[model samples]
Target chain A: MTRLEIDHLYVPVAGRTILHDIGFTAEGGSLIGLVGPNGAGKSTLAKTIAGLLQPASGTIAVNGVALDTMDRRDAARKIAYLSQGDTVHWPLAVRATVTLGRAPHSGRFGTASPGDRRAVEAALHRADVLSLADRNIQQLSGGERARVLLARALAVEAPILIADEPVGALDPRHALNIIGLLREEAARGALVIAVLHDLALASRFCDRLLVMRDGRLAADGPPHDVLSPAGMEQHYAVAAHHGTHEAERFVIPWRTLNAADRKPNQEGETA
Target chain B: MNRLPAPATSRIGTAPLCLILLGILAGLMLASLTIGYVHIPPGRLVQAAFGMADPATTTIVQQLRMPRMILAALVGASLGGAGAVLQGLLHNPLAEPGTLGITGAASLGAVVALYFGLAATVPMSLPLCAMSGAAIATVILLVVARDSASTLTLILVGTGIGGIAIALTSLAMNLSPNPWAVSEIAMWLLGSVKDRTFSEVWLALPFVIVGLAALLAAAPSLDLLSLGEDTARSMGLNASRLRTMAIAGTSLAVGAGVAVSGSVGFVGLMMPHLVRPLVGQVPSRTVLPSIIGGGALVLASDIVVRLIAIGPELQLGVLTSLLGTPFFLYLVLHLRRQLP
Candidate 1:
């Protein structure tokens, strides 16, 4: 099975520590959700894993190979990263854009092999963007653009997928559809780590959750256990409404807990 | 709802487009050879190529026009390829060697060479000095914007350098001792490929070849970069390495061209945009066509300069600017909507 290990990763942005002592181990066949409030270092941690940002200290590895030491092409072959709010600078065709996902395997001049074309075709079909293949990316609707970009990442066919806010700004139906795709990717034996803002989707669909608070991994466990009432109140400083629907558990943030609402012992607990 | 608009595909395929561009370049190059003041017919030109023509015809074709024509092709290819690479790297359609100050710095270097009377006395000093100026500007821009993490910083620094170079050139013009010196400087700034010899051709050829090769190698990486830096890096692109290669290549190719010919503008800026409709918007794919298209445009412009023969010859750079400015203004006016 494909495995990702981030050990005591300390990432700094502009010389200020953003992700401190963050560590996690993720394996294939599970959907892991990374959820946190604004500036909680979740995206920072994700970027570090994607190799966009180097860690200030500590290591990130896949299987037994150190990510820092591995050939970038080899690393790219193993880990596919989908950035938040991705924009295409040029008005490229959707098929051509998705075909860029095969950059690592296509070599220097990008002559697509038969196997590469098959992978791109499969990714286009999987993300439901096959019909829009000939359309320009600049003409795509926001939801359609999101799926096309997802198709680009899926074309990598990597063993691990790291997506930051994959469903950001999407409507409910599209968001649920994207989340379902991630779950399906996990079922197909790819390790999928997605940063999500929606607690309901995170708790209901993820096999595990990694909660971030003040640049630390505050909690890590199955979503149900990690989103306990006390855990939610402690890390998120909010009262969560919990319920079971169709035999699936869900947690929705019902109200913000201000300094005045915190118990004496919990007062000044936020860093 | 009405059906969404689709992207326009090339009615002509890439291979066909490239072949057409090549044919145009060949036809233009041939026209460049024969259409000078002393017109040699195509049959005589063929004999001249093999040294079988009369000495006068052979001397005119082999000695004079050949170097000038080669220079035009080299300068044009440099500007065109450099422009496409800069546009792709900066993710801005407007980026070019002229905009990034490399061409301006090269102009300043040539001016300095002329100011000191170094160009008249020394055989290769003019181009060498101009190339040095371009190299220095490139190094300063790269070093100050070391990260390549922020393209904005690189562009801002480049603009500042370009402004400084133009100011220095103006200062040189203002302080000239005589009207003759001033006119000489002004004429050089207007840019031309007249009366150049094989020496100039030999000087620029290597740098242009190396520089264009570097840019062509960068095409695939540039394609990946159009998706944004973060995504490009995630796909194993060594972005800093790519940036260094691109800027250095621009300096060498464009710097050497500026050294040999003066500042030929708009060819670099316009060719890639013109080639885009035929090649689609992929940055890498736009490169080769831009190179060939650039060569064709310059050769055609040079031929026009020769054919005009009005009073004195029209400036090559002046003709390009006359053509390029309208296209540039159109781009600015329609900046809101992304065009193919």
Candidate 2:
């Protein structure tokens, strides 16, 4: 079954269209990378899917249910979203913050059940922050905080996990660890969709890639096909060099030019 | 199998802490009843409590001192709970009732009510007016701040509004027609629990109860909010709705408190900060402790106020200001040091 479906999604903010005719589908247990530059509306699309922002038009569906029709709590149970930046006021313990993911399942009085506690502990373990469970979140380093946030989302145990630049602020090792964790989640039958800026990471870690340009999907396919030199030149106006390193493919943007040089770039004259 | 580690109780749980606080509150209640200028014996106070004392002593204890003590506890608790909620919502430890201007607005309302002779005609009318004023001011502040507004903007705007409200209150007090109106307004502004009767306590209780319940209900939401707005919303909690509810609930509780006790400061601002670290910064746990601590602080200050008076009683506000100003300065410096 398709775990998430976006059909003709249009999003506008402040009278400016940020996303137009954007659509995609991620089947269950798939790791999909959403790749684009700064103005590609990647975060906006993620927010719309999470129901945090209303689309200007079109529809988003999760498990064949229209997102607009479902209650926020029900949507929350099915999908968990982790944004690019988070601000925490109080210096809460890591365990305390992660336990907040079970808020939807908990009653109005917010008493965590046995199941909730187990989920929190499991998430902390999965994110490898169990040793720091009692430490204050604010006292942790940036990478540690990012892992803690991932643990918080993991505690939700939702089938669809949407993370926008989840590893943007982390070191290379921590970033790779987070990508590995997301892959593990996908292997466990969760749809893991991450909006990422690192083309090399996307090419290596993701099973499929969706390239966006100017608020529209430019290409969608396996990484080898979608990240070709020709596609990169045509859509991104940049030349990409792809090579295999340590049994993994890496894509790097090497140069940029106008449409006049597109033909030569596509013909591999630059190489 | 290894025995499951005993449920961590290094920090006291909510229920036991509540019981202990209730016990302390009960003791304070009895102490408030026993200690006075007339020095009613503890036995006599207990007898009066049980309705076994002479009518005169009974009147002095039940009708005079008992009501004032109850009002003090209620008002103190309300201020403390409101402060915790506000601080959590604003995500700034410096955010407090005084900073937000809810108390100033309430005092202005009370002064207006007094000037119009409405307080004399109806005892509850003044508190009602004060509550409405508080609600209006809070709504305006929230509307202006909106969802995306920064904490700095919220505090700056709140401080500006608070200053304006205080100015208006001073103006109203100065312009009163009755010769006693100025003194009455001055006394109300300064804050005191002296010479109060049961009638005033009854007038304020319902509002306090309703407001406190609302604040308690918002406790869990406040905890989620401390994680910040976007996180809260992504967790299926509506941040705007929670913020509105918190502000409204706080205004109602603090407004009633101000209308009755006349702008008692510091309790609302200081209680939450004093208890948050102790309770691990969880809003759910901070609520009761702040209440207990606030009550204790205010009651202790009130006792001191009574003890130090020579001819006429000094206002509780005066005592609180004298105690609180230094703490406020320390907080300002501490917050500056902690800033990035």
Candidate 3:
């Protein structure tokens, strides 16, 4: 029942346009992966959708109401965002850190209600950090801290969850663990938008993919269609190996595109 | 009524810690009343406290000792609370009024007022000017380092601002019209609660109360900020509003303290760190305890000044600076070890 619609969105930072004419419509019950190379405005787009950045133009409507007019608390209650490499400044207890996600619903004074407590507990459980709840957040390993931060985001219980590079800089096992958690959240009916660098994981796990290049949306469709070899070379400048594992399509970037790899007809146009 | 799980490392509950600190503060206040120059016996101290004793004893207790004690507590509490709030807001353990150059800016402002002879004519101008200076410093720090605010940038910029303010204060003294003005300004800069009357006490009380309340109110939002700014905002925190409140509160509280007692450095910096271990590092929980701990510290320090009976009565600011400089160095060394 949750719908997020963006139309003709333009985001400018320091007079430089970072997101150009971006528009998309997403709803609950699906996992969407935002894929692009560095400086492709993937993070910018995620931030705009999460209401962290102000779009210079266009409308962002949530469930038919324009986001511009929505109360800050109401918007917060609907959208949970986890920034890339999010850090805890203090060595706060893990449970205390997760409990902060209840701020939007905990009223002005931040008095915790029973529902807030329940939500925090459930989020801790969902993110598989329940055992570390009593430990100090700063003392945790990077992977453990990632789960704790994810738990903080999940504690919001929002319909739309936006995570920018949620699994970056983690071991392969921890990365898979976080991706699995994101999938579970989507399966539970939240619209999860994750900015991912792993093409194989995106292709296998994401229901849909939105590809970005030079601050523009290059392609949008099912990952199978959007992550084609031609699209991969054109957008990400990567020559990828494509195959199917157990009937599910996957993509692996084999090597960076060089001038010799391009066909004669495409050679003169661009790299 | 609190349900948040206590930190596993926490030795005592926050509530009990606060109560114990409060008890200690109360006991210290009582002891302070009895141990002054007159040495009113504990039995007579109670009578004087309620205004039932002879007029002279009553005057000594109510007019002299009471205002001094209350002012110390208020100033100390504001300094401590401001430090906790700033540290949380900036996500920097080194952020405090002293380290951030706020107290120096406030001192410069008061010194300016004294230099121009405005304080003698218009007493309100002193705190007003001091608060204005502090607000300007806070705004400058925010604007100049708005982007990353790395430790290097914050500390360097703060040192620059503080250095400039202190140098300017010295310049004002050098250009003073007479020896009396220089001596008066110099003595005030040493900082003490000596001879403070109810007028000075009343002047600082409202600002301290309001500032402390603002900091306390903003404490919970600070907890959100620990997750970083973008995440905190997504969690419905108004980061800009929080910044405004923290700046205004620090300015008012630190300014008022400086106006009455010159610049009592390092109370803000030390109190939070001292109390942080007891209640855990959660910013909100750290705040109340830091404030109460600050009150206790200044009260005890003021009593120590009286007990030591050093030459010229040992200015409170000088002692704290003497103590604080070493603590600040230790903290810097500690941070270096931790980071690398």
Could you tell me which residue pairs clash in candidate 1? none
Per-residue alpha-carbon lDDT of candidate 3 for residues B1-340, written as tens digits (9 for 90 to 100): 0122454366577789899999998988887787778889878878988999999999999998998999888888889999999888887878888899998899999999889988889988888888888888988888765775687688778888899999999999999999999998899988889899998988788887888888888887888888888998898889899998999889998889888998888998898888776776777777888889888888888898888876668888888888889998888877775542
TM-scores across all candidates? 0.94, 0.92, 0.95
* Residue clash pairs of candidate 3: none
Question: Can you give the DockQ of every candidate in the order shown?
Answer: 0.56, 0.43, 0.56
Query: How many pairs of residues collide in each model?
Result: 0, 0, 0
> What is the descending lDDT order?
3, 1, 2
Worst 10 residues of 3 chain B by lDDT: B1-10
Q: What is the docking quality class of candidate 2?
A: acceptable
TM-score of chain B in each prediction: 0.90, 0.92, 0.94
Candidate 2, lDDT over the whole model: 0.80
lDDT of 2 by residue, A47-77 (tens): 8788888888999888789988987788888
Instruction: Choose 1 or 2, whichever is better by DockQ.
Output: 1
* Candidate 1 lDDT over residue span A1-271, tens digit each: 9989989899999999888898889999999999987889889888889888989899999997899999998898889999998588888889989999999788686589999999999999999999999988878888889999999999999999999999988999989988998899999999999999899999999999999988999899999898999888887889999999999889999998998877766675554
Off by more than 4 A, model 3? A263-271, B1-11, B49-56
Q: What ranges in model 2 sit over 4 Å off? A: A14-17, A255-271, B1-10, B144-149
Name the best candidate (by TM-score).
Answer: 3
lDDT, each prediction: 0.86, 0.80, 0.87
Tens digit of lDDT per residue, candidate 2, span B1-340?
A: 0011221123566667667777877777777887778789888888887779999898898888888898888888888888888887767776777777777888888878888889999878899888887887788777866654565677677777788888988788777777687887888889988888878888888888888888877777888776666667778897777776777788778888888899888787788877665566676677767777678777777777778858888898888878777876787776775544
